[model samples]
Target: MLRRLFGDWRPTVLDVLLSLAVGTAGLVESFGRQGSQPGQIGDPVPMAAGAVVAGTMLLLRRRFPVTLLLALIAVGLAVRAVSGGGYYAAWHFYSTLILVHTVASSTEPRSRRGFAGLACVLAAYAFVQTFQHNDVAELMIGAVFVGVAYGSGILLRRQMDQTLRLAERATRLEVEREARARRAVAEERARIARELHDIVSHNVSVMTLHTGGVRMRLGDEHARERDMLLGVEQAGREAVEELRLMLGVLRGTGAPGSGALQPGLDQLDELVTHVREAGLDVRLRIAGEPRPLPPGLGLSAYRVIQEALTNVLKHAHATGADVVITYGRTGLDVEITDDGTGGGPDGPGSDGHGFDGHGSDGHGSDGHGLIGMRERAAMHGGELSAGSVPGGGYGVVARFPLEAPVGVR
Candidate 1:
């Protein structure tokens, strides 16, 4: 046990320290024995030698417990035979007790028969030593020492097993929680896809068909009106294509390699560049020590930034924008503020997204883009708020937790 401490193949510090302590105690007991004590071995040489052997033997207790106990018993008897009196070193006696307890606590000695034999021999050794002195106190104390050591070892084993069981149960519960969360997210995505496909897509398709039919019926004399109708028809087709892409993402069938389909914060620079080229002066600032986020979580944050920037370009008529990402203690915060419009979805320069009638602040627009952004935030147990900033500008802010909740709740 004293060879080393705390390496892969070395004994622990406790083991090494305990062995050293026991060995040191044995040495003191052997040399410091009283000359007047009744039945205590008088000769110091053989008893001291026996003490040292018993002390060293403790090092092997964990690996060869049976052999150690047997060796101690033999050394104790041999010391008795060599000495003038019938007694042996008292330090060896206490050292044997420690080894007995160690063997009882561990599971390496699997044979019950072997353990029973060891217990019998231990009891016999105790009785023989105590018999030398007819005092009732000596006999009782000796027996109590052996019993307590064995009982303590049994208790330790039970405690170790209970701790392991609790750790395993906690791991199982964590796995189940994650699985349930993913399942809920998938189910909600599927439902949204279904609504878009059945109702929204169908309505858009009918409007496009009617527009095409009307444009065809128009006469060549109405040239201006025909060109206007042609523009509407083209816009409707583009909207359908955009809807198809959104549906593909919701249904988990979007091509992974498509840049617009899957985006994480790692590609933030590209997004910033795109917004810059769109004629909106964009300033991207990040605060705090940024850490890697979960893939799905990063993607969600990217989408939020994308949507906010899109709104600023299409609705806010903003000439410049500020995007601030703060990696906070509990989670992350994304804020986008535009210099132009100072209202919500239905405010100045708004495209009528139909948000205010739903009890939103300054929102009564006939659009779903901002609503989709809010839904995305909520899916990750996050919140999104959009309105005018303190000054003469509009802002969108989203907050998401690092260790997010299991589901939307």
Candidate 2:
């Protein structure tokens, strides 16, 4: 309830209650039979009007603190007019201090300072008026409350500034995190695109060449084989044309030149052989219904696997690592994990940023190649993730969607 009154500029239940309480108390004191002399009592009409104005202005102070300050000045003058130079009700002093605090807490530093100065002048004027009437008690009470109100206002303002600073800092950190990730992805994607272009172009060109060579070798007697080879040759040529068209979109988005011929799964055995020869015991596991993959996808899968194994060999420092490829109905999943116990270059407990930074933690984990892997998967409408795995090792996983070949289903 108090928060609503202090923290915002809306009409709140507490504002309503305070308005009613203060207005009613002031009115009752003005009109009710008091011990003061008859001449001290104010005219009923103007005093009642002042009470209502005071209550309404106080209720609106959150939204218009400055305006309320101005209104409080006017209302005090009206009440004083009716009192005929006699003492005013305590409610007038109470309302002035409350509005002063509201303006102090909510206004900007410059405006608050200006308003507070004017308010103190007016408060001193009111206190002097009371002092002349021999009311020392009211002056002392008003002084203490004004000081307390100013203290609380300053504290709340500092708290508000601190909260704003923290919020801005958090927002800036989030933006930096996202931009860092985006730069990584763009770099890797451009490279992946160039690699894809090289892969598909070479594979299709080879197929077209082989088909044409075989067709030329066939004699006129074997008309059926010649016709089949011719058809294959035509298809391969069309595929090359299509590949060229597809690569138009990928041309400008390239990184450095890749190997002349990107290796596919057919080269995995040789890769594994070299790793084993380097003294790393690596195991390969393949599951799912294996089928011939598109040139780009096959090369992409091979690259993902190769990168993982190379990281394990260079960074994992473990005796053994495992690679798994699972072909699903819609896509294939590749996962590589290492024990990190091999006392290798990166040593144990080192994890890469697959969300791992390559070689940052000596595990070639998280932030390492994450953007590239993500781009590769994204090329095929897929995704990738890498990070520390359970049992003191690191893992990288990538998924790529595959389209079944025409007439194969």
Q: Tell me how far the alpha carbon of residue 23 in candidate 2 is from the true structure, in angstroms, after superposition.
A: 2.5
Task: Give the C-alpha lDDT of model 2.
Answer: 0.71
Model 2, residue 319: distance off in Å is 8.1
**In order, what lDDT does every prediction score?**
0.68, 0.71
Show model 1 residue runs off by greater than 4 Å: 1-9, 34-41, 108-137, 195-200, 203-207, 218-375, 378-409
Query: lDDT per residue, candidate 2, 11-114, as tens digits?
Result: 78978987998889877866773445654563565666787888888788678766777777777776676566566666776777777677667765567555
- Cα lDDT, model 2, residue 337: 83
The candidate scoring highest on lDDT is: 2
- For 1-409, candidate 1 gives per-residue lDDT tens digits of 5445423444557667667877677667767774657755477778777777777777667766656777777777777777767665567767777766776777423568446635744754574564276587977777688778766766776788789899999999989856754554455455434443544555576788899889999999988888998888888888888877776766565423222334578899999998899898999999986888865667668877887786677666678999999987778899988887434457555533222222111222124455655666786799999877777777888998886334523
- How close to the true structure is residue 4 of candidate 2, measured as C-alpha lDDT? 67
